[model samples]
Target: MTVRMFMGDARVDAIAPDDRGLAYGESLFETMRIHRGDIPWWDAHMARLTHGTQRLAMPLPDATRMYAEAMALLDGADGVLKLQLTRGGGVRGYAANSDAAPFWMLSMHPLPNRIDSLDTIWCEITLASQPRLAGLKHGNRLEQILAANEVRAANADEGLMCDGAGRVIAATSANFFALIDGHWQTPVLDACGVAGVMREWVLAQVDAHVTSLKPSDVECADAVFLCNAVRGILPVQRLGARAWPRTHPEIRALQAALAQSHPGFEPLLEAS
Candidate 1:
């Protein structure tokens, strides 16, 4: 991993110990797929970031300068780029310090390991309903962390999480989609869950529904997939004892379509 830090626009050596992001999780982030030093979904990520900053009352970084630095950090490498924006340092309290500058970091990480198909488990950790924060990629992710731990303990690549009402929300780290009766359906993010960039792209590409999902819906679906900006589209081969075909036709078709539209996901199409 490689990182560069900035406070507002100037370079920074380290995050202050009292940074709001560390003190109270007062921050947001966007993880993007970098292909040959360029981000194909830059616009989508930026839009989400802008929306998040507005909601949280945080300052938006200078995009042109950020991109230039990101490319320099990527150095023509194909990998993951994580952009984190914090509300800057605080003075040991929850009250807003309106004068503080925004603190941001850009880091590059190696590509995620390729999994032919994901083996998943249904996590017992339920997401809390917080509509105000729903659909935003905020820094506080204790729920996902706990759920991912459950997945690891179960020896599954990912875990399906649900809200307290038992409505399926999403996977530990990605958006969830299932094929039901020839239609693509994903859980609604009105209550909780991050609305991923790839999910937005997929929704635009296919006729899909954003609605409530039951566990039975997932179990009985024709096929399932997990998506994130970093990992284009990941087919789910097994969830608990239920198994889906390794060669799901819709999965392959979607992957191909995504690759055609985004150069970053092109390699995934051939492999899928």
Candidate 2:
């Protein structure tokens, strides 16, 4: 549980007690995979973080300093790096003044053991319809927390969550994709869910289509998978009582494609 705190350009021992991020989850975060002491998709992660800061009207810490600190923390280690940026300490209220300096933190954590396959469940708690915070990795994750609780209760690897209108959004902590009609299809995230970095890469590699999807659409697909920057790509082997064979070519091809693009996934792809 080692952590390296960053408040603007200066490192700190602890966050201010009145920080808005702790008070009301007013923060944004990026969870990335470290490979050979580098983040393969660093540009994408930074771009999304910048977009989120602008969209939320929050100030950003110095990017160069943050990158240097992150690299120092990695120290040639391969694992997960989590960066969190908050609106800093602010007065207690809903309306945030525009003069607050941002507080950020960078932490390193061990990667979860790689699972060859995943068993996901359709969560009962639906994602709330909030187009304003749709694609940002904001810290207001009570929904994901609740959905993950459902996953824990079901003893499943992950949980698939749908929007209030029954449109499949994403997994609790990752993006969802299915092989439908011979093409990869993922739910459009205009209404909810965080658009994951690895999901973006997979979409670009496969020319994946973004469309409205239903639970039945996923259930009847040729293959389904969940992806995140930390875990690369995970093929879904079982969803509730439904099962997918390990020999699905589309899934295999995706693994190959990912390995070709990123060396971190090569070992998983070879084993697959």
Tally clashes: model 1: 0
lDDT of each: 0.89, 0.87
Candidate 1 lDDT tens digits, 138-232:
99999999998999899889999999999999998999899999999999999899999989989988899989999999999999999999888
Candidate 2 lDDT tens digits, 1-272:
76888677778899899899999898999998888888887889999999999989888898888888888888687888999999998888977864767899988888889887799899999999888999999999999999999999999999899988999999999997899889899999888899888888888888789999999999999999888888878889898777996837777777787878887875353353
Q: Candidate 2's error at 247, in angstroms? A: 4.4
RMSD in angstroms, candidate 2?
1.5
lDDT of 1 at 140: 95
| lDDT of model 2, residue 120 | 89
